[model samples]
Target: MTPELTRDCQTVADRLRATGHRLVLAESCTCGLLAASIAAVPGVSQHFCGSAVTYREQTKVQWLEVDPDLLSRHSAVSAPVTDQMARAVMRRTDEATVSLAVTGHLGPDAPAELDGRVYLAVCVRSGGPGASRDGRDDPYVVHAHALRLHEQLRVQRQIESAREAWQFLVRVALADI
Candidate 1:
């Protein structure tokens, strides 16, 4: 792993540990690089719940429950899909208090408009009064952003995306929630 990626993972790991938050992920385009990066951090298992690598539309639909209509409307790499992925991943893992989802088109064969574009979403569970229909106290606060990668090589793009994802996770973990 690159030094920058290691540092990013360390920062995210530190923040999650400080906050007592367990993280889970749903990934595509970058595949499982984000999870792998975090896994490199020592004692990461204490804060990481695991990841769902939903690289295929069928898997995204069946595993993360991403809406087929949303996929048809906005494509798999869109912000809406990542938003759903972030929230749904947390639902799948009872131990996770935070979820991160990333999707992108980083390839030579990607559509011109979508090439090098990535979307990321982070969801944090918080307690609030009457936050759910069943009167449960837990509610989620979600944040989503887009990234444009400048790397020309696919492998470089994946590495850069994973590094960027770790940085995003640090920000989300440190945020007031």
Candidate 2:
């Protein structure tokens, strides 16, 4: 990891520890880089639940329970699909208080418009003072973002995406969201 990314991971770890939040991840184009970066931090096992690398559409559906309609409508790399991926991952693990999902087309084979486009989503469990309200389970509040990488190489794009994910985590963690 780059020094900046390492710092970001550490910052996220520290903030998560302080806020008593645990994290899970769902990944696609960046593969497992985001998970790997988080795992690099010492004692991360306490705050890090796990990650799923759902590279294919089938896996995204089977593993993260990403809706086929959303994928068909927006593609796996779009914001809606990524947001649902985050919510699904968060729901799958009781240990996770926050979930981050990333999907993107970062490749030489990607369509021109989507070649370097990536979508990231962070879902934070909410409902203050109660697990449920009005007899319904608490809902996760999701924050999503879109990014375009300037890198041409697949590896470079992946690295850039990973760095962006870490940075996003830092922002959310610090905000206690």
Candidate 3:
């Protein structure tokens, strides 16, 4: 990791710890890199709830309870699947106040249709009556409303870079919190 990224992660971790917030991660293209980065921080165990590396569709379905039909319809990289994965991680941990989900095709060879694509969803839980469909839904809604980023690279390099990108995003989100 770069110096800036390391500082970002530590900053986010510190804020979460101070706020008494817990986090969980659901990763696909980035594997478990995001989780590992957060875990590297000293005292992060208190706020880092857990993580699931749902790299395969079956794993996402079986472990994260992502709807198989949704996966079939939109593929694993779709916003809905990412949101579902985030929700499942939060539910399983039972203590996560924030959850992050990532899925994407990390290489130029990742099918013409999916080349250089990435989808990220961050869910933050709020305490309130009738929160309505969990806070994961809010992130999904925003995801649908946003303009996504796109970049092209070799498949092998993309996969490796996606991990770094996801970790960077985690650090940013932690800072925001």
Put down candidate 1 lDDT per residue, 25-133, tens digits, no spaces.
9999989998988898999899899999999999999999999999999999899999999989988887788899999999889998999999999887764221333
Tell me how candidate 2 scores on lDDT.
0.86
Q: How would you order the candidates by lDDT, starting with the best? A: 1, 2, 3
Deviation in angstroms for 24 in model 3? 0.4
lDDT of 3: 0.68
Q: Please list the Cα RMSD from the true structure of every candidate, rounded to 1 decimal place.
A: 2.8, 2.1, 4.6
How well is each residue in 1-177 modelled by candidate 2, as lDDT tens digits?
Answer: 778778878888888777778889999998998899889999988889989999999999999888898889989989999998999998898778788999999988889989899999988878422254353464788888899999889888988998888778668644665
Which residue pairs clash in candidate 3?
107-155
Q: Roughly what TM-score does model 2 have, to 2 decimal places?
A: 0.92
What stretches of model 3 exceed 4 Å from their correct place?
128-177
Task: Give lDDT per model, in order.
Answer: 0.87, 0.86, 0.68
> Which candidate number maximizes lDDT?
1
Residue 8's lDDT in candidate 1: 84
TM-score of each: 0.92, 0.92, 0.76
Worst 10 residues of 1 by lDDT: 127-136
